[model samples]
Structure formats: C-alpha cells, structure tokens
Target: MKQHHVWTWPIAGYLFLGGLGAGMSIVCAVADLFFGKGELLGLAPLGALLCLCLGSGLLIFELGRPLQFWRVFSTQRAVLTFGAWMVILLVVFDALYFSFFSGWFPWSAAAGARAVVAVIALLLGLGVLLYTGIELSSMKARVLWNTPALPVLFALSGILTGVAGDYLVCGLWPYGGPAADAEALAGILRPLMAGLAVATVVSLLLYVLMMYTSSNPTGRTAATRWLRGSYALPFWLGAVAAGLVLPLLLLILGGMAAALGALLFIVGGVFLRFLTVYSDDRRELAGERERLLKLPHGDEPFLKSNWG
Candidate 1:
C-alpha cells in the first residue's frame, strides 16, 4: 500500500531521445536509399548518433550505480540487457554510416559498404524505438503501459518527431545541404510528415480509448486522469492541439508555418513522453488501502514518545 513514484523525467527523457534518434536514423537510411539525398552530408546520421548516445547516458545516470553500466551486457535474458546491446550496435552502425557520408576515411567511398551499414543501422534503430515502449509495457503492474497500443503509438510518434527534426536541421544548419536541396527535401517531407501526424493522432486516440475501456480499473483511472483529471490540460492542449492538430495545419500551410509546426511537433513529442511517464498509476490490490490507512501516522504520539 505504500505510495511510490513510478518514474520521473530522466526515464522520460531517455524514452523521448531514444525514439527521436531511432526515427532520425530511419529517415536518414530511407533518404539515402530512395531519394538519393546523400548530399545531406551525414548531419542526420551524426545527430541521431548523438541522440542515442545521450539517451543511453541518461539511462545509465538513472541507475543506482552508474559506474556499473557495463554490467548490462552480462546477461542476455533481461530486456534491459537486450536494449543495451541494441543501442550499442545502433550507435556503431550509425557512426559508420555517418563516416561514409562525411568522408571521414578513405574507405568511405565504397557505396556498397555504406548501403549495408545504413541498412544495419536502420534496423537497429527500429529495435531501439520498440524497446523504449516495450520496456514500460512489459511492466504489468502499470496497466496504462501494458497494452500493445503503446509500442505502436510510440513508433508513430518517434517517426513523426524524427521527420520534424530532420526538417529543422536541414533548415537551420548551414551544413545541412544546399538551399535548393533543402527546399526539395522539405517538399517531399511535408506530405510525409502530415501523413505521419495523422497516423499518430489516430494511434493516440485509440490508445486512450483502449485504456479508458480496459477491464483493469487502474487503466481506466489513468485514462480518466488524462481525459478530465489533473493531466487534461497538457493532454488536450499540449499533446493534442499544439503537438498534433496545429502541426498538421502548419504543414498544410507550408513555408514558415511548416518550420514552426516542426518545432511544435518536437515539443509535443517531449510532452507526450513526460506525461506518459508521470501518468503511470499502479493497480491497487484488495484491502491494501485499508491496511495502509490503519497504520499509525509518522507524527503519531506513540511514535513520537520514543518508547524503545
């Protein structure tokens, strides 16, 4: 019956950054393979590599003993261990992919090797994305996070945010690409981002609906909190309106509106991760509340008397 915090901003930051990094890697790989936009000069891949590295750092920092992070590789059965390896491999491959684009070494000129590296990095990136959601959903005690919808929702949001990030980097950074190339990339990415935004909206709605109607009372309570309780303002305004709807409208408007929308999308993605982390309410067992209430308060006279 003892109250304990589920998770905090550090965990949320790891989740958000992990997903965003994975998403950027995916976009980078796809662009090279399909659109022939290798002219991006490896900025996207480098950004993704940094994001994953930073996210991994946050996870390690959250551990009780941060110095023993290498112990994560000591076991293969644990989900966290698997995730750790996934991140390591993704980072390695992503770095290689970036080196190819950046021409960091003489071997970087090999197109076949670069393509292979990109594909591997892309797959590993996806695994990292799924792992972020699965890490939470596997905890059955938190009914709000136990559903399959969570991974799907997380994946969609990750990709959306990743595209937004790519757009922003290409727009703001001088080294991103030539002006004409950036414009062309934006033209291609605009419609893709809008579609992803729509899909994310649908996925989010479905997730909330599933939680609200779940047989588990805890799940319903969590959903209710987001719908009409203390979390409603952020859920409705931050996540839904500014994060999703407004972004969709801006994408439609194009030009400066599109850039602003991308920024909002990134903000909204962060908001979603934080809100989800904070909203994890555990399921209550029968008679647990009553038993806790019957226990003496910390400030009770008997406890204060120091009769020991």
Candidate 2:
C-alpha cells in the first residue's frame, strides 16, 4: 500500500484553531446563560468568529485551489467534505450572532432570535471540534489515528484550550469591569483549569496506551515513535510537560499565575497539533520493510540493509 502525507501544518492549524473556537463558543454560551457573566459573553462570540475565520482560511489555502473549495460543500464522504461545510456554516452563525449582540445588527433586541443563532453556532462549533478527530481517524492509512480515543482526546483538548483561552482573555480585558471582577472570574476559572487539564492529560495517556497495545506492527511503531524515538523529547516536553502538567500546577497557584498557565496551554495545544501531524508513520510499515529485506537479500544476512 502506498502511504500519502496529504495533511501538513495548514491542516494542523485548522484542527487546533477550529477546536479552540468551538470550545470558546460553548463556554461563552454556557457562562452567559447559566452564570450570568455578562462581562465575559462578548469574548466567546468574538473568539469563535476569529478562530473560525482564521482556521477556515488556512484550510482553504491548504487546498491549493481556492476556487474548488466549494466542492467540499456539495460532497459527502465520511467527515472530510462534511467538515468543510461545518466550518463554513459555523462561521456564518457565529458572525450573525456576534453582530446582533454587539449592536452591529439592528434587530439585536430580539432575545429569541439571538438565542437561536447562539445555539446553532455552538452546536456547529462542537461538531467541527469532533470532526477534526473523526476526519483523522478516517485515514485508515495512519496507524496512530485509527483509535476511537483520538476524537475524545481532541474534544477534551479543545475544551481544555478553550477554557484556558477564555481565562487569559477575561483576565486581560475585564469587559470594563473592575479589578475585583477579574479576580472573581479567575476564581471561577481556577478549578476549571485544573479539571480540564487533568482530563486532557488522562485522555492523551489512553490514546498512546491504545496505540502501544495494538497488535499491528504499524501501531506499535507509531507508539514507539513517541515513547523513545525521534518524537520523544517534544512529545514529553511540549505536549505533556508544558501543555498538561505546567498548566495544571500554575492554575493551582491562581491569581497572575493562572494567566501564565493559560498561555502555556495555548502553546501546548499548538504543539500537540503539530506533533500529531508530523509524527504519523506514513513511511513504509515494518512488515513491508521485513518483506523487502527478505526478497532482496535472501540467504545472505550480511548483504541485508540494517534499515530497521
């Protein structure tokens, strides 16, 4: 079988940004409706809109033919084409809802209408988040992406990064509220940061563990790449240390320290996306290598290449 390295940094950016946006939208909606954090409401929509636009733009540029991007909308094949449409639709809903609430749209007073748009956009955002994982998993050729845990891992990470992003933004711009309000918001976010960070860490462990235990040689090779291979240092330092552990510890300190944790979480999220894209064992499988070695140097062990 021929291996294809179709996804690159652009796709990785799309995945990370889309999840970030979706997570922020959901967090914003929940906060506004449940917690009455009026000061934090605007951040969610604005963040969602910004993320959707930027992420989708990267995806379009990645396509290499922007004119043909519309083809994704007209087609339906697993989550590939469907995901493209999801991004577009979420952007529209987020934009409309944002404009309405921000006074850019005249009919902003209609609470019912605003609520409807917000709900649709939030659902679409979540769909886009899950789609990132589903799309990757659909690529049967990538051994590391085949597990069910991948989507869960991504969804958890998305929510984790989303909450962290919200914490950072709210800390910086308290939406005209006093310093105490920012402190109050931080108080709310402290526990959340710890919980989400823990979830992301646990989900990641299960993902790697699944790959490690797979009976397939390709799966085993992919796991080994992270454990003690070329990708080991970055995986541990960037994804686990910076992204998961540091953020959790910082949040426990609270106050200004949580803001730093949020920053690290964002960086960690980006690194995770980059590593996942680059670490795939798209090279020839171990079984294929063994077969080729047997065919080319049969009965002559000294002549066989030590490529393994």
Winner by lDDT = 1
Off by over 4 Å in 1: 171-177, 292-308
Cα TM-score of candidate 1: 0.91
Q: How far is candidate 1 from the true structure (C-alpha RMSD, Å)?
A: 3.1
Q: Please write out the lDDT profile of model 2 over residues 74-144, one tens digit for every residue.
A: 75675877888788888788777666556656786677777787778778878888998888877777778
The number of residue pairs in model 1 that clash at the backbone is 0
The residue-level lDDT of candidate 1 at 55 comes to 87
Q: What is the C-alpha RMSD of each candidate to the true structure, in Å?
A: 3.1, 6.0
What C-alpha lDDT values do all the predictions have?
0.85, 0.78
- Cα deviation in Å at residue 103, candidate 1? 2.8
- Among all windows of ten consecutive residues in candidate 2, which has the lowest summed lDDT? 299-308
